[model samples]
Target: MFFFFRKMNAVYLAAITAAFFMVACQTNPNAKKLDTGTEGTIHISVDETYQPLIDSEIKVFESLYPKAHIIPTYKPEVECFKDLLNDSARLIIVTRDFNQQERDYFKQIKITPNSLLLAWDALALVVNKANPDSALNMNQVRGIMDGTNKDRKWQLVFDNANSSTVRYIMDSINKGKPLPTNTMAAKTNPEVVDYVSKNKDAIGVIGVSWISDPNDSLSIAFTEKVSVVRLRADNGSDFVKPYQAYIGIGSYPLKRGFYFCLKEPYRGLGSGFATFLGSYEGQLIIKQFRLFPARLNVVFREANLK
Candidate 1:
């Protein structure tokens, strides 16, 4: 009844530490370390945008491999990257791969990290449930980000200035234009959702996983408070929400890749966890949350837009 996708690039895999895999995995002699194996405590820095999906992934992984303890430290994407740089984090889940600057820094240190693109993620615009304005086109959203929008009543809300969501809008949508001074900042993604849920005049930018699955209790609760705005492409006429199919086919205009960067020199808990996340079971969790899974063969579907 379950469909398994192809294994991810071997760079992301680790030896299945014994007494952990109900199913077997061949041990690699070239693996990084021998002592830690598959089961051990690990601290990971994760972007708050992926807290929901990663939380689900961790729960399932821990259930299967009881000896593993993955302690996730959720923060803004920028902070997560900083954690990795200072050697405070062994693994991190974020929206992007290493930039040239980061690569150069690591190269100077003689450490080339193994980073994997795990899945596709989207930036969702949320409005109050009572608000009627629920759709935004590429130009319109760009106007809001670049402070060109004529409407003064609508205020823009963000997770954090240093967060990837803000950077994506600034770099991708605003095309390097600076944000307006009036932009609002919340501590985390849930805060953005909560703020939009209460403020009809505000548009909250958040990750799609927070509200993509209607059957999810948290999604239902978020839906009760706010509505996900439909987005139209730069040239397209029809608006599409950040649904799985929309993201899969590239219809969702604000989609980005979800990645994992591991700093383990040997096959440690960090490597094991990254392997689990990119594995079939890991990709399934991404699919269940309505994001496009990188490991699976996906067929995009079109649905009626709200």
Candidate 2:
């Protein structure tokens, strides 16, 4: 009777231990360690243009790791790189890649980042929905940004100072021509949207990701207010628009990749967040924005591939 009782007690304890671990595994892989550490702070710097998407990504990350707190700092795309070089930040999220010169500088500094390509986006040319014109060829866009075209303007085409839209248009399409002297300069994209919304002659250039994701409230709102411009091969090959579908399918002519450049190996919460953003979960967040998630396979609408 004594031996039987001891055996039953041992079996009960073993079953209890197994159940505890099973429950812990079902909750979160990090849950067991949650109480072992106190609060941790991390700083993430991102370009203003990507603030919206990066903000969303960070939110999702926090939800998964409740104890982690991240403070995000926003600056211009160029300035974000400047901060990284100065060691003021551990991470930077931006729309462009490091140029050859910048890459060489990093090599000299002995800092090679573990880069993660987050998603694919495009520079878009937008006109007021009220405008009669809805399409622009690459040459036409180039002319507007580089001042090579005389027909584009607020007085003639639409007046808006070349923001990133104009800058990218010039750099990518025209190489380096100055924007038309008559271009109007709006302080931000929203201002551009507002100006174009009210003025039929005005056109705006922006990133396709800004208005592509209908599920994202902010993106949908922008799409509802402005008209996205379409592009075509001047030889009448095909008319391409800035829809996520068109861009994903490689039909859009102005696509670019978004990247994250970290200053060094992460040490704490920043590292955790970085790993999360570069992980499968984080890439899914990118796909949710209607941009093509990179370094991970994500499915989009069938039209996106065509």
Which model scores highest in lDDT? 1
Compose the digit string of candidate 2's lDDT tens values, residues 184-284: 66656566667777887776666565555647654333367878777885554677775556566678888877888776553556556767777888877
Off by over 4 Å in 1: 1-37, 214-222, 300-306
What 10-residue stretch in candidate 2 is worst by lDDT? 154-163
The alpha-carbon lDDT assigned to residue 225 of candidate 2 equals 82
Question: In candidate 1, which residue pairs clash?
Answer: 32-266, 33-267
Q: What digit string (tens of lDDT, one per residue) describes model 1 on residues 171-262?
A: 88888888877889987787888888888888988888877663664322235568888899987778988877778778789999999998
Instruction: Give lDDT per model, in order.
Output: 0.83, 0.68
Candidate 2 lDDT (Cα, whole model)?
Answer: 0.68
| Candidate number with greatest TM-score | 1
